[model samples]
Target: MWRRRAPLATACAAGEASLFVNGIDPGYSGDTAVYGALSLVTRADSILVQEVCDYGNYDDFDFTGTSMGFGLTRDDEPPPLFLPGVIISMFGGLVRNIAGHVGVELDEMRQRIEPWYTDERIECAMATIEPGQLAAVRFAAVGVCGGVPVITVEHVTRLTAAAAPHWPYPPDGHIGVHRVVVEGEPRVEVNTHVSHPVFDPTDAGCISTAARAVNTIDWVCRAPSGLFAVADIPPTELIRGVMW
Candidate 1:
């Protein structure tokens, strides 16, 4: 069957830039298309646009529900945004040209998300309780798109407490927070937003101090796992995958 390749090409062109399909039909049976697609990486900052980006009929083996794995290619390291699905609405949005940049509008592009985790309001799911000798805290995770709330993570738990050795004074330091629980153990939940991209090294020191103060509170506890892995809303430099 001579399947349609225009749909795939269209989807690719609607994004950050346009992709030349080299006049190949995606329906052609075999892995040749896959190789041809992979070979496009030599170009500068290009992605391997999957013509039929959806999961195959094999439902059990198909990871389409949680991760599309669309085979995005970049010249540098990839973006840190963990996208589990494709943005269906993006196909209908207005396409903009940001100077030399192509694809969708800047504001509209920010709205695209694949959902790494569900959204749960930390205000409701989490609480800090200082019980005399010990301190207990809980946090909630929410999936956000373009600054808007979408899903909530009510089941998972992730918590981090600022550590000692005091990060550093200038721009040459990295601070780590403790999880308050043993590795591979169930834990309490905690929710808090992190302000990343400190821009200046001096400012980073102040933030690190603030983090340490939070952890020093008697006994601050948190969830052992979940979305609280890398803090929250990190800078583009700190992120590795395609951020919604």
Candidate 2:
């Protein structure tokens, strides 16, 4: 368990650092490996989890076959094969051939733009995924304009029921599920978005936010349905209260 936890921890930490330094959310990159590893260990099968980044807006997660390793993004522009060879060819044909081979490897590595997720696809994924693995299937988007990270985890059963007649929101936005207590029994709540205060970048604040996010996800994933209970105040607010 500790070994399993280490990869995710490293990945999350790296992602947080990338967010602060590059203003790019690489969480999905790290998350891909974590999700893949989790699927393999839990199901004893190889699985490929790919993240499609819309660059500064939102990101979507979906599973693929093991053949699709570290799937490509739309932004990955391919290098010019013949053009580069032409330049080197002026120097020598041998050099040009070498360059072409290198170009081939580069092209192989670059992934094609991943397609956007649809409501039907997400619903299907949710239905097929093991309850315990739901957490890894979650999607998150950091608002580049606002720098706020909105994390979304789904409960398929709840979401399907919620969309009894029709789901109102766009498919992309329907990534979250909520928890509520009704008649002394726990139930899935729909159409609720949980917002937490943006973590302050101060050393202490970052540490606190990371810890709480980990703890919260762990608790939520273990629940019967994959959702977190709403808090009156953001968890960061609570941390501030205690720290201050």
Candidate 3:
């Protein structure tokens, strides 16, 4: 069910970059979905210095790519019956057919726009960030419904830290004593989770290229609900889990 297609890239004079991608969910009746996205922010003024170092350079941009498509559900075959069973089967088949058509059109659009963005242009568009500042990147997804496309979702993540609170006990009545204590900044971890309509781990070439482009910050693509566990698990358990 996988298609041999490359990501479609585009940039605007206003310093915006874009990438359109297509992936198929083989497990779900080979249903294909398209993900059209704006380019990730990469300027030194937009990303944290520590995060930039994590990627080895200020240009190493991390992004949460998203896509949207119909939530196709696979229906179970029903017993052979009269009009009721026939109607159910027909409706299910019709829905799948419509989804398939949308997928094809999306793929065609991606292919048509491929030439607009070249390798050199894409590299030049990725900006860099400075140290100690929080990253200023944003994430959004394009969705198609009834043959029309629209912006369906948007997200943003921020990194922050606060001083640890202190507690003191009162002096005993027998002895007069006073004590005060101050604590350093409390360490906090920031996590950004993004969900896409479809993902294919087998796309080694695409994944490798993206990882390198972002300077390899351990990007993960998992099931829609899998991200919830990231907050509960330790760093060692933050393993990559993909749902196709």
Candidate 4:
């Protein structure tokens, strides 16, 4: 079996080089992607980054069914990711990073949860849904600046692609995408559609997250020894160190 341990070795004391990586979310979307969108507009109102995907294609029954509570009913409490303090602890840094970039002092961080329940039973790659079970969920982490929600990170996860009809989605209605939407004059929406020839949308998300670390390795190695935010270093001009 493939095995791994945390990469604890670093050149901090020597201070010759560094390695920094953030596995997805506020790091990739908030720190890096949103900044690109903000660069396009002079006047900004609010910013949103969303990962919209149908987990049914992920093919991991245990993860989606138990860990994510995808097939859970109202009687069951929400997953740990949605529990109090989880989103904040996980995403608060991204919010603060964006706030710092935008020159706003955050008043507070807020959380919002919306669940979509299904009336009929359904089967998918991840879990078998029962009547009254959750078909989709929307979770948002908001950064309030000057009494306004200036920055937001949202997840729109569904058992099937059609679960959350009213929520934001990719223009092509694909299964997996990272969407960055800046609400401003000359507003821009950047949708990064993720796919793999071998894996489905869910597995492709896992692959894409892992790729962030690989793709940015060169840029990170040459920097001063420290942790990194997405804005700290720009990526190379093109893909590198991979064989076709």
Candidate 5:
């Protein structure tokens, strides 16, 4: 993809700039936030970042019920997002970005998929999920080194809390969260929660996503031109105000 955008890099080299940002999954869920907790990294055998979200209050039917395949039954065709290699296609950059910073040359990429079905009807905020429908899923995109997994991005998402009772839960037992775990280094963990007084987790996520993009504009414009990771850019002052 970057190969096709060679001109963007060239423009950046000529003093123009470009910035790529995303929401919770490839955004705070892994790349930048995952790198922030490396100070305690005595030894990192494996680094895992997770997003555990309960979409019960998220009212976007197109996203939750459709895009994520939350209301589909076992017999229904899998959503395009859940098709083979789709996880890697979506999150491989996140794995590669972290690997590039950790100085690990990944040998291959792999994905783990576990789609859970709802045993009973679910009255979700976005749509109704009948029994046997795909109500939750836990999927991971892993980057390997020497045939061992080194960096991974996982998501355990459900339309409602009752869908995947056996799967991984949020660190704070909340409706939404992003958790990062470094297994070998003191077992350090970082959990980020974004919530609003008036909005649901879905809307909160959307707001924070745009906030990330807006806040990074200055850094991106000042940095050198090229495709880069969060670590590649120079540090700047960060402000958190109530302006939002």
Candidate 6:
């Protein structure tokens, strides 16, 4: 597997680098093709046997097919997206137009989860993403509150694995992942999407594939609570700590 891991803070500062799949571009590549190539990129893609699949089984809940809105803020920053009961996915990657436009509004329509703090308590914890075949961008923002850190993520893309955003797995293809670590808040937030639209799906599995990369690291800070809130943390108890 081809692998690249860098500090999320430094790489994202310039908006030049991506999270999981470093060099891959999301514009011109096929989503399924990217997932198939994971074995060559990180040598860890083979580990997935049943984890990545269609969401029809999950009451038809797919992350790739729909636009994603993820962010971290203090209890007072006004919920980023106002939509109710919306879950963000980390597996599904977003595609971008050549000029770099995501084509979606990230503003919170309604508050789904309450921010934990009010005093600038948000800072980028870390980003774990797959850049994709055409250089798709994944962003994570960080802020400080009461000396604590709050992290937020925003994704913009032109392609998707599903025709609709609520499908379980995209009719298209996706990337795989082994592990991801974001440092800065001592807490971890892992998010991923599992589906995409068929016509213009992009390879996001690369982000999942790079989750196990070892060279990357971020700073960890203390939070009001001891644990962070992320959706995609591997089940160490089930995997016996050998997730990849």
User: Where in model 3 is the C-alpha error above 4 Å?
Assistant: 1-134, 146-155, 159-244
Model 6: how far residue 50 lies from native, Å: 25
Question: By summed lDDT, which 10 consecutive residues of candidate 3 come out lowest?
Answer: 109-118
Q: Can you give the TM-score per candidate against the true fold?
A: 0.14, 0.20, 0.17, 0.85, 0.88, 0.19
Considering every candidate listed, which one attains the maximal TM-score?
5
User: Per-residue CA lDDT of candidate 3, range 109-205, in tens?
Assistant: 1000000111121111123222322222222222334454321222222211110012111123211111111111322212212222464212332
Please state the error at residue 49 of candidate 6 in Å: 26
TM-score of 3: 0.17
Against the true structure, candidate 5 reaches a TM-score of: 0.88
Q: What does each candidate score in C-alpha RMSD? A: 23.6, 20.4, 24.7, 4.9, 2.5, 19.6
The window of 10 residues in a row where model 2 has the poorest summed lDDT is 17-26
Q: What does candidate 6 score in Cα RMSD to the true structure?
A: 19.6
Candidate 6 lDDT, 51-111, residue by residue in tens: 2232211211133322232222223233323233332222112211100121232322111
Q: Which lDDT tens digits does candidate 1 get at residues 99-156?
A: 1122312332322332121122211112221212111112222333355432221111
Candidate 5 minimal-lDDT segment of 10 residues? 233-242
* Candidate 1: regions farther than 4 A off: 1-19, 22-94, 97-108, 112-244
Q: What stretches of model 2 exceed 4 Å from their correct place?
A: 1-24, 32-45, 52-110, 114-194, 197-244
Which of the two candidates, 1 or 6, achieves a greater TM-score against the reference?
Answer: 6
Better of 5 and 6 by TM-score: 5
Cα lDDT for residue 118, candidate 3: 13
Model 6 regions more than 4 Å off: 1-63, 68-143, 146-150, 154-238, 241-244
